[model samples]
Target: MRRRVPNEVGIAAVVVLVAIVLSVLSPNFRTIENAQVLLLNGAVIAFLALGQTFVLLTGGIDLSTGSNIALTGMIAALATSAGLPWYVAVIAAIAIGLVVGSLNGSLIAYLKLPPFIVTFATFGVAASIPLILTGASSVNVRDPFFAIIGRGALFGIPMPVVLVAVAAIVFSVVLRFTSTGVHIYAVGGNAETSRLAGVRSARVIVLAYALSGLCAAMGGLIVTSRLMVGYPSAGSGNELFYSIAAAVVGGVSLFGGIGSIGGALLGAMLIATVSNGMNVIGVESYWQPLVIGVIILVGVVLDTHRRRISLATLLSRFRGPREAAAAAPTS
Candidate 1:
């Protein structure tokens, strides 16, 4: 059973190894303060990655996630400034996320548009929102109560990390134990076959993108809360990491319908660890982008390998069944 380690294992192992290496290289890396910082930084990315997993499982992508985050975050901040109740402002953020996500879903599923084009288009829309809302200025959320939601600690555990843990657990349970999860995988694996087999492939695709939107919103909230402000460009460039790294590293099939929640978390942690470690090590800030690019490329190669293996395995299963039929005695 343990002979062939799963591809997820590679991601998990690498995440752990990177954390350890970072710890060793920097004295501050092992401190409790650093743990909190890393966790806070990690939470939003993980949340977005969770959303990306859904779209990816359907053989789709959400380039708009980062922009969605910025837009949502900005809205939440603006609402708070307008004297809305803190909880109400938060709800507004989520509602915006749902609306944007559902829009992407509608276009892809109902209109039969390519997921790529639909999401890519929304990406521009999402990105533009912050600019319009901010008028090119960042919005700061300073209400003590609202600020607590973003930066406050509870019993020594950072709230952001807790939020991430909850999101992951819920997402994992839904994906592994619900019909909707199966629908997502089916649609991604083979839309025509799944549709013919009575699965609602189009609905699944729509739902996947909607889920992606929700995840991006949650991530945006995390960013807004942590920074106590929403920058016009908050979460910019994050989709580059979220879409490819989370899906690829988490064992989510690039072609659709395969993934594990734990793997996605591992992937997020790995990226966070690297970025944080590099910051602590005094590496030139400009060089981080190059390192990230290389890492993403490696993940893409691994994803391709996973797809090939899945295809080969399915073929073998088909061949085995045929061989059994051929060996049966004629009646």
Candidate 2:
């Protein structure tokens, strides 16, 4: 039997190779300060990708997560400015995420709405709410303690980085070791079959979207805290794109039910490195999207090919035994 290497190992190798090449090309890329900055900037994308992993595992998508950041972050900023305790404000923001996520889940899971349509509609709604509330202005976060969530460090690591690291570990464990994880994969693999086999596909789907919403809220907090302002346009830009790209590039299938937290994290690192390396090398910012788009296209193509190969192999196995039995000559 041939041993197969995990996709994560290949992605990790690519990350290391890229880092080495960038360091050699750009002296500044090798500095500790640059490394810290890269990680900090990548934190938001990593968090979004983590949540996206859960949803993707359940054969779903979350177009609203980017807008959810703007909505939740603005809410937190407003609550704090209105004299609520920072903790309370944070809680309120998270609650809003849960509500939005639940709404998305209910529509898709219970109402049988398409995931794309539901999330796309909510994306517009979520993005619009913050803009309307602020009258197209950014809200300043006056609470000093709020800064810790994004800027404060623990044992020399940036707070956002530390938070994401913890989240990744927890989510990885949940996906790898829990029965809920099995249900999630089952639902993604074949929703109808899973339902027939006694799995509550609807509930599992809702949970996945809800978790994605929670992660979006966390991303909102970090971005708002780092800037000390809740920009109405926060996360409305490249965030959603980067998140999807990271997950797909990390080996998460577009068809779902096949991916890992570690792989997504490595994908995030690869993206962050490319973005940072480009900036360091003085490449025009306009070219960044082009590069990322190519990466995404390549990932999708590979995923499609892999799926085809797996299907072919499975068909061969199923036909092999039947063919052998037929050749045995029945009495």
Can you write out model 1's per-residue Cα lDDT over 168-279, one digit (the tens) per residue? 8988888889998888888888888999999987778778878888888888887788788888798786455654676676677677778877888888888788887888
Worst 10 residues of 1 by lDDT: 238-247
TM-score of candidate 2 to 2 decimals: 0.98
In candidate 2, stretches whose alpha carbon ends up further than 4 angstroms from where it belongs are: none
**Candidate 2 lDDT trough over 10 residues, lowest sum:** 236-245
The lDDT of model 1 is 0.82
**Candidate with maximal lDDT:** 2
**Steric clash pairs (candidate 2):** none
TM of each candidate vs. truth = 0.92, 0.98
Estimate, for each residue in 1-331, the C-alpha lDDT of model 2 and write its tens digit.
9999999999899999999999999999999999988998899899999988888988899999999999999999999899888899899999999889888988999999999999999999999999999999999997899999999999988999999999999998888999998999999988999999999999999999998899999999999999999999998877887888899999998898899999999999999899999999899988988999999999999999999999999999999999999899778
